[model samples]
Target: MKSPAPTTNRRNGSFGHRSTPEHLGYSPTSGHNSSKVSRRNPMAATVMSVIGIFTACFTPPDTNNSKSFVDSEEFKSSSVASEASRSGSHKARGSSRGVSITLHNSIQGEPAIVKFTMEEIFQVTRNFSPSFKIGQGGFGAVYKAKLLNGTVVAVKRAKKSVNEKHLGVEFQSEVQTLSRVEHLNLVKFYGYLEQEDERIIVVEYVPNGTLREHLDCNHGSILDLASRLDIAIDVAHAITYLHMYIDRPLIHRDIKSSNILITEKLRAKVTDFGFSRQAPDIDSGMTHVSTQVKGTAGYLDPEYLRTYQLTEKSDVYSFGVLLVELVTGRRPIEPKFELKERITAKWAMQRFIEGEAISVLDPKLDQTAANSLALEKILELALQCLAPQRQNRPNMKRCAEILWTIRKHYRELSASEFRSFSTSSQRSASTKE
Candidate 1:
């Protein structure tokens, strides 16, 4: 559902809904190295958890107990970023081009955001060639570009329309928020170009596509149950880091499937910070950040929609919708379903309560004993996340822990089932002999 235009006051808590086009191409979200670092740095934990879940559930048993999961090459590469390397080369090029003045706060340890000249931007994109265009959103069109150093990046060019006042605000908001945080599961900020009518944001290119695309089978493969669980946990960790670990808490107003970028390894990286805002400071006795409501239709928190009081829990509410989406493989709103079943979360929860939760599992997934058990537990957590009141929901940190426990149980149950089948096959072979 797209809103027409801005028609309400933003300060008085009135919402003039903003509509972003459905981005079907690769999201310009991911990371490169930066001098700025996260305070409580959870990248190590994220790498360990990701390796553990995928290895135990999907790979053959690792008989070499001496090999720690973290020692694997995949995660080791994730810990070390190439953004710092790529950005340094770009800065030197910018200096030679006489655009060094455009750099924002260049320092010794912390380099400024790479300021790309309009000429360079045009050259990389071939003057905004249609063939290079990947997707479109409310802010602007996205293009895949290859930089001079051969580093692939995503370039987001703001629409030149003079009427859309919110586009500029959204662009700046995304830059400010992305620069402040760094995480394995969050997009990295590379640079920006704001010359005359051009306003562009350059971020790391996430090759795999949006979670929504994969869910819709646009990638020619269905996401298995283990992959879905890993995605949910990855997103939960990202949001939890934003809400708790950052110097100031932040709320990522948009948390839909389209905003989540999947990596080649199938891990999730939360993107689209245009609606992100710092949370209310509890030390000042403030309870919530009263602001204009901005979120997708079905994922918007009911409480925030009604009262216009945004809190950290508002994000929690949206995460709940995401959880439902992950398990059922259904969009938040399915227009073709019956009136009673149009809202996917509501319908799925009703079925869960009615003891028919198994019926709603995505047809693509083969229903097994482990899958069924995980479905019920995941839905139970989703129910809490979708609760009408924000206080009733679990915080993102708790959500991560619960998901971890769920994954552990899922792995154990799968192993037991596998062993049982193996033993049964052995008996049958003996009898035949």
Candidate 2:
């Protein structure tokens, strides 16, 4: 367990409710307790594609620290040349040598992106020193590095875990998706490297680790209610942006807490795009796109699982599970339970329906006196998200608004306590004087 937060921002809300909300009920559902997790019912494995966090082995050259990032004329010329040369090479090279290619997109406001060479990346990463490594996922490991011009960055090297046919496609998907959208809650992409048989992507380095680190791992902070509330709102806003803020919608096939990175101030940044896709145009009469389902377990939309049809609602359904994760702070799959009782969303929903919403909350936030209304609202939202039918779920926009409202209400309650504390402290100081 982590130490408690300092007094200044310590959580404050008087404990337990006068009574549990009248509508809150306790009912249990049967699924995924002792059995395999299914989005709906288990399907033919081939029809429901599944992939885990990807990683593959790579050989990185030792030690090069003299690579300039900001003012490298060589980067511009070399990258452009590499781009020109890359047009014809489709066969897998025995191994890729890192190359920084520059290409001009000169389309009005669109800024050009440059690729970094493997040597240049290695130099910055001190030859991929283990000490500098910050994270690892299905795709690869991430290292923290500083360029010659003194710019700090995160370099993600991909593992060759992808199929030969889809090896380069993942990288392309991320680049295309990230470049096309911009929002405070989304991670910023800097550049990419595909050389020396190593695929790498560079993005702005978020200081704090993932929300998963804070929640399940108990990383740096206690992740109090206020912070969690803020995170919930932040992520909802991000998903809303992805769903409607762009000319063409993008579905972030994965939206688990692990994928949400916390910034220095604990702001949420949604990262990773290996499985994102363009939304089908409804105006064209396509209600849902039938694509292979790709997402982490526990967070995949059940409707998508059963029907093989994907929609924005699938994302909403996943977000519902995320809401439950936020409310309960439990892993989606709990091996501790009999497999059938193991799916956390199902378990949490059972607890919520049983009028134990407060009991199901993280012990860290479980108060004996404060009313459970705040949590009840959140539970209601989570259930709405997890509604069996996709149409029953609220759109991301409404979800964001509701979350923001809940977060604001939570902050208001905290503010009252903060004000009272300040007044009492000032009175004591003056009395001492």
Candidate 3:
């Protein structure tokens, strides 16, 4: 006999009502819906425990062993089975909580679906050592960790010491939202661990660090024009994925240079979903009970800040600010600036629109030829993205495509010049001979 559905309720002290798939306006595709499932079901508890045991057993005997084991079929099969079991168990639990749990496969592989145990996470992170600490944010601390198999990973451990009531809800939201999301430009979530008082998320470790760091560092040669354009395209693609590709449109309430991580190859990936939310069409103009007015102050959408109504366009505005950062290499907010001229995007765009693009290009790039026309084109795109009206901004996909096209055009122009120079040199050589 099929098990009875579990009860559904927002976790302890959850402010909003449990969101249904229908309410979110997305039909259940995975046969299970997370919104319909309860986290308190016995079967789910049992499965979680079982999976934890398996993880403990199968975890590489050492970090080196774990890396080797990850490539083996045994690891893949175990991970798949564990994930399927977790989803099934979650569905059974959901019946009790009145929430639906939907299971979906990630394109990168099913490994992202597997859930880790708190014990395993702690073991992997070496007890969140100070030496391993990579960065800290409003919600948690990021640690650089190496699993038994030698694969480096970034572990985001929620601040458990903070009141559990707040952390619990955020933890659930992040796990449910990030588990199924898979895109090349977005950061990959390997798995998560939820214990009584602690929660942790494992993601791919990006070695190149944050965009903010590169901008601040003395590394002048690192962020050349090509590199800047490439990062912009990648970040735009990631935003596009959240805005359009997902069934429920997500608003990355916070989008800043610090949130954009880069890899060794300089590929950019957007990270930190702690403040992200699925924009509900029904509550188009209403304010929800979010924990706080959360967002990096400089990147926050003025309209959103005023109306308390979050939307995908909020992200667009923030992205526009990022574009300005890339072009001018200026901080979003500078106390040194006059109070009225603090926000950089509006300031830079206004200057560019007035045909003063040369004045706004970062002084670091002063030696480089200033293409007023090309800068104007990029500024125009930024203006559209930063439009005060939500309807006026281009979506992320279009934004990325446009930036890519600009880069391609610039490359072609340079290539043609190079070819012309080579041909001229060959002709001169022949005449001399």
Candidate 4:
């Protein structure tokens, strides 16, 4: 859900609820390079547990492994950025000519997304050509373009109507949050362009569209049981990192399918940090930090919605809704369903509590092929995540461990099923010949 206009400073307890479009895109609401330096981060135990679970059997290569994807060549070429941001003779209609600036690595100690000049960005996008627009959201329109260095990127340009101060906040909020964290499961920030009436952020062009698109029928996509389980574990790891690994816990206020982008390799990357806020400092010993409510309606935690206070657990609650999506492949709010079943999470939880949760599996997944035990365990995990009391919920760390176990079960089952099918096919071919 889009946040309303500013009523109060976010730093304090006060928050403005006035409805206004935020840089954050819409859905029901919803970073990797930083990963390599800290290979032995505290979350290693959970990672190892996951690796052990699935790798114990015939391990399929992590083809979607974001760990191996990001190299120096995958980012902006040093050769192009070395020339610096020099303004050319031509300028865009709205802004001033580009002023050259040397691009430096982020002070956060990681390679930064390449900084671009207004002129260069405009040239790459053909002066914001309508045909090039890929998507529009609360933040602004996203355009796909290729830089002079041949790097494909998505540019999120702020809306013209948003005030300068608010736009500046949106820009800085994204850069500040994304720069501090990186993992294969998060979207990579490329660079940004901030100039007169223009606040644009350039990020890695995630080519596979979004999780929402695949779930929606219009896209003609149907993910099998194994693919869904893989995505669930991938997202859980990202949230685990955000809550436990980062210097300060971050509350990702929005956590819905639309904000979750899928890569060509089918790796899930979380994006849209407009409403993100830092959790209470470690020394405070506070269980929760009070803030204004800002999240999509269906996915928002009931507790966080009722109380302005936010916590790491709020993300767990939202992730529960995500799990429901993975399990049932249904929207958070299914208005077309019967009145009693309108809310996807409520319906799923009811079925799960009644020991019939498996009935809700995606019909496209071939129910006969699904592993009952894994489904039940993941459903139980979802229920625990959706607990009304935030404390009752497993933190993202525990959630990741549970999902890892489920993924291991499902992966082994899928691989065995594939082998059996292959054998059957070979036998049939020989008989026909």
Best by lDDT: 1
Q: Residues 1-433, candidate 4, lDDT per residue (tens digit)?
A: 1222222222222111232222311111111011222323432332333223221111222444321111000111011111112222212201221334236443434334345788877887999999988877867788888766566778788888736665566567776676556666777665677767888887768667777777765456676667777778778877876776555557777887887877666667778877777776645566788765666756777667555578988899889888888878888778799975777777766665555656887766666553565666676677667766676677776777667666766677778888999999999999999
Q: How far is candidate 4 from the true structure (C-alpha RMSD, Å)?
A: 15.3
**Global CA lDDT computed for model 2:** 0.62
Please tell me which model should have the higher TM-score, number 1 or number 4.
1
Candidate 2 lDDT over 18-113, as tens digits, reads 322223132212211212233123321211121111010011112253211111000000000011222223222111323334553434433344
Give lDDT for model 3. Answer: 0.58
Per-residue lDDT value at 420 in model 1 = 96
**Location of the lowest summed lDDT over 10 successive residues in candidate 1:** 71-80
Model 1: clashing residue pairs?
A: 30-188, 33-83
Superposed by TM-score, candidate 4 places the C-alpha of residue 336 at a distance from the truth, in angstroms, of 1.7
Report the error of model 2 at residue 321, Å. Answer: 0.7
Better of 2 and 3 by TM-score: 2
What are the lDDT figures for the candidates, one per model? 0.69, 0.62, 0.58, 0.63
Ranking by TM-score: 1, 4, 2, 3
- Which candidate, 2 or 4, would have the higher lDDT against the true structure? 4
Which regions in candidate 1 have their CA more than 4 angstroms from the true location? 1-102, 106-111
TM-score winner among the candidates?
1
Q: Please provide, for model 3 over 20-112, each residue's C-alpha lDDT reduced to its tens digit, 9 standing for 90 to 100.
A: 111212111121111213222422332233222221221232333222111100000000001122234434523432212233344333222
Off by over 4 Å in 4: 1-101, 104-114, 162-167, 416-433
